[model samples]
Target: MVTILFFGQLKERLDTSRLPLELVDGSKCLDSVAELRIFLQTKGDVWKENLAYGSALVAVNQQMATEDTPIKDSDEIAFFPPVTGG
Candidate 1:
């Protein structure tokens, strides 16, 4: 199982803060962040827009990750809008 954390507008759009996904054997190797976006899109348009947009950021195991990062079972992935703070 993979734990996906949603934040900010993403959470609001998805209507949930967290999502748990079960991965089959072939699904374990996620090569790009774009793939994750597509997976979330399966839920509906709201998830697709919020996550697939250019404004959102991705993290793996609490550290920022790019699309090429590999994903494994039990990995913690987080998605959120870009942060702006003074």
Candidate 2:
């Protein structure tokens, strides 16, 4: 099972705080963050825009992660917007 967490503006935009996916032999089971983004797109325009590549921050198990970062069944993944400071 994979635990997906959304934060900040991302949560508001997607109207979701958390999502859990059970890994199995199907499309829902993703290998990497890139694949996850593509999968999320299937949800519609809201997912596609919020999860766009190079647009959001990703973390795997509390550590920074990239688009190609591989995920495991028990991994805890989080996504959030890039921080901006004035």
Candidate 3:
């Protein structure tokens, strides 16, 4: 199983603050950030738009991650809008 979290405006847009995912059966194969995004997009159009490549910032287990970053069961993934500096 894995945990996904949303933050900031992304939380509002998605109408969710967290999700617990099970990587079993057909989903057990997910192993990278890009793969995860693709899977999540299947949830709906909102997921597709908000989580599109490079659209949101990501962190895996509290550390910054890239598309190729490897993931596994029990990992925690977070998504949020890009931060802007004033």
Candidate 4:
């Protein structure tokens, strides 16, 4: 299982902070962070909206990550809306 945390507006929209994602059989993980987003979108309309919107920021292990960043076991993935404070 992989740990996924939601932050900022994402957390509020999702109405939860964290989730555990169980990889499907035959594979221990997904290909990359973007792929994970696609997978999460399958959950429901809320997930599809928040995760598939193509504008959220992603971090892996606290480091900013691109869509193609590789994902493996025990990784901590986080998603947050684009920062806009000024």
Candidate 5:
């Protein structure tokens, strides 16, 4: 299973702060960050735009990671809007 955490607008949009997903063959994994973006796109147009434009940031196991970051079972993934609190 993969633990997905949502923050800020993403959390409000998904109506939840966290979700646990079963890792299936085609499911989002460490090496498939793009796939995860696609999955989020399916949630709505806002997600599609945000993911496509890189408006959000993704983290794996508390470290920032690119879309190509490899994922594994029991991994923890978090998503948050681009930081603007400077």
Candidate 6:
């Protein structure tokens, strides 16, 4: 299982702060951030919009991650809306 976290407006927007996910058997060997987003998108239209590519920032095991980032069981993945400073 993987631990997925949502932060900032993303959490409010998705109405969830965290989730535990089990990878499907066949896809376990090569699961990635992109695939995770796609899976989450199935949750609802809110998730589909909020987790869309380039809509939020992602991290794996607390380090910045890209779509190709590999995901493993027990790993922590976080999603946060992009921040800007004035």
The prediction achieving the highest lDDT against the true structure is: 3
Please provide, for model 3 over 6-40, each residue's C-alpha lDDT reduced to its tens digit, 9 standing for 90 to 100: 99988998999999987665735888999889999
Ranking by TM-score: 3, 6, 2, 4, 1, 5
**Cα displacement (Å) at residue 71, model 4:** 0.7
lDDT of each: 0.80, 0.88, 0.91, 0.85, 0.78, 0.90
Clashes of 1: 1
How many residue pairs clash (N, CA or C atoms closer than 3 angstroms) in each of the candidate models, in the order given? 1, 0, 0, 0, 5, 0
Against the true structure, whose TM-score is highest?
A: 3
**Model 5 TM-score, 2 decimals:** 0.79
Q: What is the TM-score of each candidate against the true structure?
A: 0.83, 0.91, 0.92, 0.86, 0.79, 0.91
What TM-score would candidate 2 get against the native?
A: 0.91
Scored against the true structure, residue 73 in model 3 reaches a CA lDDT of 94
Per residue, candidate 2 scores C-alpha lDDT tens digits across 1-86 of 89999999999999998999865556446889888778877899989988888778999999999889998898999999998999
Instruction: Show the lowest summed lDDT stretch of 10 residues, model 2.
Output: 21-30
Local accuracy of candidate 6 as per-residue lDDT tens digits, 1-86? 88999999998998889998887756454399999898899889999999999899999999999999999889999999988999
Which has the higher TM-score value, candidate number 1 or candidate number 3?
3
Per-residue alpha-carbon lDDT of candidate 1 for residues 1-81, written as tens digits (9 for 90 to 100): 789999998888789999887655474544456677777787787777777757689999999998777777889999999
Off by over 4 Å in 5: 25-31
Model 5 lDDT tens row, 13-85: 7678898876675643434666776776777886677556477899989999898887778889998898887
Instruction: List candidate 3 segments past 4 Å from native.
Output: none
Which residue pairs come into collision in candidate 5? 30-69, 30-70, 30-71, 31-70, 31-71
Worst 10 residues of 4 by lDDT: 22-31
